[model samples]
Target chain A: MASFPVILFEGGDVPDSLAYRAGKLGAEAYPNVEFLDVAGPRILMAPISCLGAGFAPDFHGFIEYRATDQGCPLTQVMVDAVAAGGLCLSACTASLLACDPVQVFCATVLRLAPSIDAMMVELALAEAVGNAVIHGNLGLKSDLRHSLAGLVEFNGRIAEQLRDPTLAARRVQMTALPYGDNGVEIQVSDDGDGFDVEHELGKPLEVGAKSGRGLALIRKVSTHIEGGRGGRTLVMRFLPAG
Target chain B: MDIFTDSHSDGTRFTLKGVMSFRDRDAFSVILDAVNQRAGAKVTVDLTALEHVDSFGIGLFLLANEQAVGVGSSLHLLNPQGDVSRIFDLANLDAILSLKQTMPATGATARNSAPPRRIGIDYRHLGKAEDGSPCVGFSGRLVFAEHGHFQEIVENLIANGGPRVVLDLSELEFMDSAGLSMIMIAHEEAEAKQIALVLRNPKGAVAQLLSLSALEFMLEA
Candidate 1:
C-alpha cells in the first residue's frame, strides 16, 4: 500500500497487470495512464494517476509518486490530503500537482478557503537523480506507501467512529494541490506539520530510514514507480486515474 | 412545535413530530430536569416526523445525552432522516449515540437532536470552479487559495467566540483546503475567542474527512 496516494490523475498510462492487481487489492486501480501539464511540471503518467479513484471511511490520506519535476507537487499532494482529512505523507517531492481541484476529493469538506496557487515551473531538473533513486531501483516501495496510507486513513476513521459514535455521521471533502516548484516552504509551521517526516532526525535526514520497507513498497507498485528526488523540485501533474 | 415524549422506568423514548430548533432549548431544559429525577433508564429518541434539525438541535441532543448518561442512562436515536441524520453525522454523534434506522424498543433518549424552532435557516447555493470542475455553493466543495486567510479565519473566530462552535458540513458535497482551513480557523478563533465551534451533522464524504484530519475533537465544543 502506498503511503500518500495521489488524489488526481496528472496523466499517464497504467500497465494492464497493475490495474488488475490493484482491483484485486480492494482498491480502484487503473491500467491505462495519460500525460498532462495540469500543474507545476509535466511528465509521463502511470498507474493510480487519477483523482477520486480510491477513498476510505475517513475520506483522507492518499498516495502519489513522480519521477521528475522535483518534489514540489509531491508535497502538495500530501498537503491537500492532510487538509481534507488532517493527514498526508509523500516519498519524493517530484509528483503531479496541476489538475482540476474539483476532480480530486478533499479528505475533509469545509467552506472557508485561502486561494489557489497559480505559479508553474515549465522546466525539468535533476533528471539522473529522479530516474535512479525514485523510478529505478526502488519505485514500488513508494507506491505501496501511498496505497497503504489510504488504508490507514480508512482504518483511523473506523476507530474514531467507535470512540465517538456521533463522529460516524460527519462529512468528508477530498482535494489535491500541485506544489509550486520549490514548494512555498511551510517552515516554522505547527508541530504536526512534520508528522510523515521524522522531525526528530534534525532538519534533513538523508535517504530517510531503512530502505527495506520502502523497497518492498516499490516492488508492489513497481510499474508506476520512479526512483530518486530531483534536487531542484518535486512538483508535477498527477494522473489520478491511470 | 409540540414535542412528544415517552418516559418509562427503563427507558425514555421521545418522538419529535414537528420543527425542532434553538427556540425550544428552554422547554427541553425544563423537561430534562423532571426526567433526570427518574433516571437510570435508557433514553431513545425517534425523529421520524421531525421536519428539520439545526446546529442547536445537535447541541440539544448532546446535552440530553450527557444529562441522561450522568444519571446512568444512555441516549439512542431511531429512524432519523437526511436533514436530522446529517446534523448528527457532522457532530460525529452517530458513533457516540445509538443511531438506528429503526427505533429500538428500549433506551433513554430525549429527542434533543430535533431543533426547538425553525427560523427559516434554509438558504442553499451551488457553484462550480473556473475549470468546469463541478462544485456546489455553500455546501459545495471549498477551495482556498492562500494560507494567510486561513490563519485569519481562526483569529476572527477567536474574537467572536471561544473556539467553541460546530460547523454543519453534512450538506456540503465538495470542499477544498481553503474551505477546510476556514473551519479550522473558525475553530481556532473559537478557542482564542473563547467561543464554542464544532462541526455538526456531517455525513458521507464530509465526516470521513473531518475524522481523518483528527479535527473532530478539536472542532467540538
Candidate 2:
C-alpha cells in the first residue's frame, strides 16, 4: 500500500522555480516536510503559485510548491474537491504560551495550509490549548467558567498557578502532518495528567452546555479524532471546508 | 496608560495615550466611572495616540461601554492606529462599540481629498440605496482580522437605521467562518433593534462560505 502522504509532480515535471529554490537550500525534497511516496504515501507537485493546477480530488498528498507560494487562493478550488480533500504542503512548530496558542496555531496554519479556513482552525486549536493549559497542565475544571463568580475564581487560580515556576514553564507540543490523501493531522499534547478518552468522546453533546463544548466542537469540525498517551494527546484530522 | 480628559457642555472627550494592559485596569475603571457620570451625553475616547492593548484592556472598554449604556450615554472610539487597531479588528469589538472613521478637521475640508487607506478589510458607507435603505459596500477578504471594522461599518450604517439596510458584498473575494458569524450576529442585533439587515451580492468564495455555513437565510432576495 502507498504511504499515507505521497508527492506527485504536475505532468511529471517539477516546476523550475521550486527546483531552483530547493537546490539553493540544499534540499532534495520540499524544505520542511518529509515524504516516502512509492509503494508509499501519495506525493504530488504543483508550480510555485499554481494553486489551481493539478489538485485532482482523487490525489491524496502534499502539492509541492516553493515556500514563496504563501497567500494564493486555493480554498475555493480545494473545497470544490471536498471528496478528494485538501493537503498541507508544509509544517511549522512554536513554543506554546497559554495566552498565545491560538495565534500561534493560526499563524502556522496560514503558512502551512493557506487554503484552509483559518477561523475553524483557530476555534479548534483554541479549545485544544485551553484543554491543555487549564485542564491538563494547571489541573483546573471547566465548571469554573460556567459560573460568573467561578470564572473570577478560575482566573485567579490560573494566575496563581502560572506564578509557580514549574507550572509556568509547562508548554503544549503541537505537530502537523499530512493525513490520508488530502487532510492535515494536528497532534496536540500536554504535560499534565491525561484524562479518559473513551469517557470524554462518549459523552453526548449537550445543548446549552458550556463546560464540555470544546470537545464537541472539535469532533464536529475534524474529519477524524483520536486520543493517545493516556488522553494527554489528541490527533485531529481536518479536510477542506469541514 | 495616560488619559487627558476634555469636558465640554455637550460631552466629554478622553484622549488615551500609551499602552493599555492588565496593569492599567484600575486607571481604566476610573475612566469608566467618569463615563457613567455623564448620563445622556456624547463621550468620545480618542485612541489615535494609543499604541497597544491586550485582551484585558479590551475587556475594560467593553465594561466602559456597558456603563455608558446603563446611563443612556453613547461612547464613540476614534482613530485607533497601529497594533491598537489590529487588536480591535481581531476581536470584532466594533460590533458593540461605536468606532469613528474620520477625525474632525480644524478649519477646512478638501473637496477631493483621498479616502483613508484600506487596511485589512476595505469598506465604504455608500450613502443610501435606491430603496432609501442605508447602503454599504465591502470588498476584499473578510476574516478574523477584519471583523471589528466590518461590524463597526455595519453598526454605523444601522445607527439611525430605517426599515432596513443593504450590504453589498459583490466585490468581496473571501470570507471565513468568523466573517459568517459576524453577519449572523449583525442580523440578530439588527432584528432586536427592529431593523432588517439585508445582505446583497456575495460572490466567489464569500458565497460558498455563506452557503457552507448554512446562512443562506440571511441573504436578501
Candidate 3:
C-alpha cells in the first residue's frame, strides 16, 4: 500500500479540519516548519500566501491550503516545488513552450506519484496544459477547431499571438502535490481571461462535436475535477488503483 | 519562421529564416504539402538564413524528408550556418537527413510565403490493406497540436483514396479530445465523399479515449 505523509509548515497550530482529514486518510501529520524524523516520502502543507520557505530535504512535495487558490504565481509554484524537492514547470514564452511541456510534466509527475496510472495522468495533464496555452494564454476559441479553415485560422492566430511579447510572456504553470494516502492533485493555472465553467460543463457532449471534449475527457479520467480562480485554474485529483 | 519559396518547373527551393521551432509548424506543413504535391522533384530547404531550431523543429525536417521519400522524391537541406549547423552536427542528423553545403544554380522560378503549424504525430502511406484499400499508418500522440497535420492527411486521403482508406492507429501511443474531434471530422468528410475512412487498432490511451468519448464505434470494421 502507498503512503503520503504531511508536514504543516505554517509554523502554527494545525487546523482541525486538516488534521482530521490527514488522520482519516491514514497519514501522519507533523506540525510547524521545524525538522522532524518522518519516515519516507512526505509532503508539506503550506498556506498559499506563504513565500520562500526554507528548503526541507525530507519533504518530496508541497500542497497549498485550499486547492481552489488560483492566485499562486508560477514563480512561487517553482519556489515551492524546488523547496519541497519535487517538480514544477512554468512556460512564460509561448514560443519556447510551444513544445510538449505536458510530456515533461507527465514524466516528472509519474516519478512523484508512482502508484497512479501514468497514461491517465498524461491525457488529463495534456488537456489541462493544452487548455492553458491555447484557450487561456492565447485566447483561442474552440469553435475555431471544427474545420480545416478554422484550424488554419487557429494556427495563424497562435503564430500571431506568439509574436506579441505581452501575450507570449503569459505563463502556464502546472504543479503536482501529494493528495491523501495514495493520490495526487494537479493544479494548472493560466494567465488569461477565464471561461464560464458552469456553462461549459453544463453543455451536453455531442459525438460529432468537434470542440468541447477537453473538459469531458478530463472529468472522465480524473477522480474529481473543479474550477477555481474564475475558471483560470483547474484542479484535478487522481487516486491510485485499490 | 519565414519560409521564402522559389518554385521552378522541376522542384522548389525553400529559404528558411529566423527560428524554426514548434511555432513554425504550419509553415513546415506547407513545405511538406509542397513536397507531397510535386513527386519526383528535388526539394531543397535552404537553411542559410535559419539561425536556430528546437528538437521539434529538427523533427519537422526529418518528417519532411520522410514525406518526400513517400512520394518518390528526395529532400536536400542546404547551407546550415551557426548554431543550426553545430546542433545538426551534434545530433548527427547529417547521417539521417541529406545535407548539402551548396545551393543549386538559380533558375526561372515563382516566389511565395506562408504561415506555420506543428505536429507531434506522424503518418505514412502504407500501401494497401487486405481489401485492396489504400492504408495510411498514423503513429505517436495525435493531440491538438497535430490538428492541422491531421486535416492535411484527411484532405490527401479524400483527394487520392479509392473507395476506402484505412487509417492504421495501432502504433499510436496517445491522443487527446481534440484528436478525437479531428477523427470525427475525417469520418464525416469520408462519408460525405463516399469513401470509407476505416480506423484500425487504437490501443492504450488512444483506445480508452475513443471508448470514453463514445467514439469506439469509429474503430469498428
Taking all chains together, each candidate's TM-score versus the true structure is 0.29, 0.40, 0.60
Q: For candidate 3, report its TM-score.
A: 0.60
Query: Mind giving the per-residue lDDT tens digits that candidate 3 earns over A84-197?
Result: 545555545353244454654575687778899988998999898888878998888888777666777777887898788778767777778778777888988888999877
Deviation in Å, model 2, residue B167 alpha carbon: 22
Each model's lDDT: 0.36, 0.57, 0.70
Show where candidate 1 strays beyond 4 Å.
A1-242, B7-11, B103-221
lDDT per residue (tens digit) for residues B1-221 in model 2: 89898988878888999877666867776578777886787888899888666655776899889988998888889987655665676569889899876854210111111111222345666678888888876755554334325445546756847689888887565564445545655665677778898899988656765554556777887
Worst 10 residues of 2 chain A by lDDT: A90-99
Fraction of true contacts kept, per model? Answer: 0.00, 0.00, 0.29
- Two-chain DockQ for model 2: 0.04
Model 3 chain B weakest 10-residue run by lDDT: B107-116
Tell me the tens digit of each residue's lDDT in model 3 across B125-206: 6688898888887765688767547668778878755588888887676788878877777877787889888899888888
Q: Candidate 3: what is its chain A TM-score?
A: 0.67
Worst 10 residues of 1 chain B by lDDT: B106-115
Better of 1 and 2 by DockQ: 2
Over 4 Å off, model 2: A1-98, A180-182, B1-17, B20-50, B53-221
lDDT of 2 at B118: 24
lDDT of 1 by residue, A1-242 (tens): 13322233224555444345434432333322333223211111222232222232333433343333222222343443443323332222112111222222221111111221211110011111222222232221222212223323433433443244222211111222323332221111111111222221124322221112222222221222222123112222312112
